[model samples]
Each structure stands twice: as structure tokens, then as C-alpha cells.
Target: MKKIINEMKVRLPSHSENEAVARTVVSAFSALIDPTVEELSDLRCAVSEAVTNCIVHAYRDLPEGEFGYIYISLRLYDNREITVEISDNGCGIEDIKRAREPFFTTSESDERCGMGFLVMESFTDRVSVKSKVGKGTSVLLRKIFSPHTSEEE
Candidate 1:
């Protein structure tokens, strides 16, 4: 069977729209993969973290009309692995290493847990981030799914 790639784009004001967007994106993938409840939750959490980062960190200084954009792409490989890419054209990370550190956050004023990257890494098979100080940021995540089965081989 041929692999399938699905993509979506969303423009949200900020945290207010985060949950809705995440749900919609994940639901789309669930339709094709039929992921278990736990798998679906993991996917939603990863996407939520990525989107939240874009909303809170990216475009931090821009005013209301400036806007924020999220581009999500999902690719399913033979019903085994799913690749998700979330890209934002906003103020990129100056130091990805620092950003990924557990409990280390630049948003001290906002009381953020700073566990976004860590959670994403823990749930996905592979996680990669590419960014330029002033250009933008793109987070690529991949996860492999195995069907639930019980048998003695």
C-alpha cells in the first residue's frame, strides 16, 4: 500500500484557539490510523505543546493584527509510522538546546512549566527542530505505531 501525506494550515490568535486546533488536527490523523486512546492523547499533547510554543513564544512582540500561523503536515507510512511537522514563521529560537532543557523556560513571568519539548521527545520516536534567531522555527516529530496483539509466536 502507498503511504499517505496529509497537511493543514491554521491561523490562530493565541492560546485561546490552541485546544480546538490541536483536536482537529489529531482527529484527522485518527481517522486514518485508528490510534488507541493513549496514542491519540499523546499525539494531541505533542501538537498542543508545539502550537503553544508558537503562540506564547513566537511573535511575542507583534500586536493583534500581526497574526500567527501554524502549518501542520502528517505523513503515514504503510500504517506503521506517522510524521508530523509544525512550522511557524515567527521569531525563531535563538538557542534550541536551552529551549529543550527540562524545566527551563524563558517565560518565567508566565509560569510555564517549560516541559513542552521534553514531553514531545518522550512521546515521539524522533524529534527535530530547526530555527534561525530572527527567521522562524520548525518542529518535526515522528512516531511509530504498532497494532495491539496478543499471541505466542
Candidate 2:
């Protein structure tokens, strides 16, 4: 088997648009891996949450003209592992530990459930976050793909 990596970038102005972009990117990658419908849905949801966090939380105060970019990289390794990395150049988290707590949202008015990180963690096999207060944030997610018996000869 061989490994391939593909990357795409999208500018996010708000949380709503992130969902659509996430769906599109995840669908494309899932197609490459030939994941089940359920798995594809899960991947989309997780990617959406990560992207939303960047738009809603990272660039919350930025002006309309100011935009945050999401870079997504998908890697398929020997048909055994699928790795996705989503990054953004925005306000970046000051404290990753506190932010990841379930229901711990910085925006009470927005009614954020704070479950984004939790959902991402639950859906993917591995989830990692790297950020600096003034720099940016990068989320790395990995999920191992096991070919179904039908897919194997």
C-alpha cells in the first residue's frame, strides 16, 4: 500500500460556513479511504467542530473584513491510517486544558455548549491541540482505517 497526502485551504468568516467546508473536505477524504457512511458522518462532525472553534472563538472579535483561514491536510497511509490536520491563524488558546473541559465555554451569551473539543476527541482515535496566545492554533486528528473483509482480497 502507498500513502498520499492532500491539503486544502478555506477562509472562514463565521461559524456557519465552516460546517459546509468541513462537510466537503471530509467527504472528499472519506471517499479516498472508502469509509462507511457512518464513519464519514463522524469525520464531518468532528471537522466541523474544530473549524467552528477557530471561527467563533479564535476570530470572535475580528472585523468582518478580517478572516481566518483553515488549512486541512488529509493523509492516507497504506490504507491503514487516516490523519487530518486543521489549523488556523487566529487568537489561539491561552490555556488548552481549561478550554477543552466539557461545557466550559468562554461565550455564555452565544450559548456555546463547549462540547466541541469533547466531540472531536470522542470521534477520532487521537486528537492533539497546539496553540499560543498570540500566534495560532493547530488541531491534529488521526483515525486508523481497517479495510472491511469485502475490501480485502
Could you tally the backbone clashes for each prediction? 0, 0
User: How does each model score on TM-score?
Assistant: 0.85, 0.86
List, residue by residue over 1-153, the lDDT tens digit for candidate 2. 566655445454555666686779678866765777777777788888888887788777788777767777777776567777888878889889999899889986787788999998988889999998877899998877657557443
Span of 10 residues, lowest total lDDT, candidate 2:
5-14
lDDT per residue for candidate 1 within 1-153, as digits (tens), equals 746655445455555466577667666765676776677778778878888888889867678666767777777777567877888888999889999999988886697999999999988778999999778899998887777454623
Q: Which candidate leads the pack in TM-score?
A: 2
For model 2, the superposed segments whose C-alpha errors exceed 4 Å read 5-15, 151-153
Alpha-carbon deviation at 53 in model 1, angstroms = 0.3
